[model samples]
Target: MELRDDQPMQHEIGNRTYIVADVDPLDVDGVRTVEVGSALWLLGFLALLPFYGELEANGRVWWLWACLAGFGLGLFGLEYCRRRRKARAERDGLDHG
Candidate 1:
């Protein structure tokens, strides 16, 4: 895969080459985002484990639990979105054949 200085993405696989101009190109950005989001979600979940301690030390706040639940939901949503995109791409490939 070739990322040209002039063009956004100029990649050659086998004998075929693909070129895309100045836009959010499809290569590694999505993968990186997914990885980062997954890590954040994991950390958020870990944060929940310490919430009990925080509750005991300070007063009670249900928002902490809500935030943790939201993070878990976000993780699931991200995974679902990624899977859906991959499944659509695969289906498209099969449709061409």
Candidate 2:
């Protein structure tokens, strides 16, 4: 089958057909999930700050640092996904145009 630029690319396996597009629904969901997770991590870190001394004394200071790291990684992943999606859109536009 000829893939048409004007239509979404599709695949058929067995009896199921799947449509592939530049902007995937799952990608949007993933981005949203990452954003929420990142916010939660930051908030958790902040909320636990008052007990930092106790946590450190108990040798569990890593929790705060881990949360901070997770927040940073999440933000990075979100940006990366967004940029990748944008680039894919641009490429698709150029290809179809």
Candidate 3:
């Protein structure tokens, strides 16, 4: 079904219902990208855990730190974007489900 810009959208899957705020599709895409990027950064940090000792010994632990920083920044960006989208939806009177 086509979604209207003036209203929130609702969908049901099995026994669960989902209420979605209406926002630009491109903004949603960007949020997804941030989420995925954050996950990847976290994964990279975890992958480097086993080599932590060696990296520290070689004074190259900055790589792991960089990944952690990226993960943090990505998470912050994700939340910021999500909030902005929600606020925009609310301002447009599309927040009610």
Candidate 4:
């Protein structure tokens, strides 16, 4: 059977290939996921900090700071990764001229 040229074909000349709408895996890689993952890890680590307290209550409450630090690091990493990716895209001429 012959395929019509006007119509969009599911397969190309030789092989049958599947077309995916979301082709880029890192398309959604950004500050959001990093922040969330860091927050979770920090929270897990902080939950064990209570052991540092003597007589049930004698140590510094650093879990809050830990969370903040994780947040900051996540944000920074997101920004850095974004800029790096942008630079790469620009070098590759992927960005709109």
lDDT of every model, 2 decimals = 0.64, 0.82, 0.86, 0.62
Which residues of candidate 1, in runs, are more than 4 Å off? 1-24, 27-35, 60-63, 94-97
Show how many residue pairs clash in every candidate, following the order shown.
0, 0, 0, 0
Candidate 3 wrongly placed segments (more than 4 Å): 1-29
Q: Residues 1-97, candidate 2, lDDT per residue (tens digit)?
A: 8755587478899999988767633434266778898999999899889999999999999999999999999999899877776777687684311
Give the distance in Å from residue 75's predicted Cα in candidate 4 to where it truly belongs. Answer: 1.0
> Which regions of candidate 4 are displaced past 4 Å?
1-35, 38-60
Quote model 1's TM-score.
0.43
Q: TM-score per candidate, in order?
A: 0.43, 0.63, 0.65, 0.44
* Candidate achieving the largest lDDT: 3
Q: Distance (Å) between predicted and true CA of 66, model 3? A: 0.6
C-alpha RMSD in Å of predicted model 3 compared with the true structure: 10.1
lDDT of 1 by residue, 1-97 (tens): 7765765467888999988566775543154465576677667657766677777577655656665666677677677767766777687684311
Candidate 2 positional error at 97, Å: 18
Q: Report the error of model 3 at residue 46, Å.
A: 0.1
Rank order (by lDDT, best first)? 3, 2, 1, 4
Model 1 weakest 10-residue run by lDDT = 25-34
Q: What is the RMSD, in Å, between candidate 2 and the native fold over all Cα?
A: 7.4
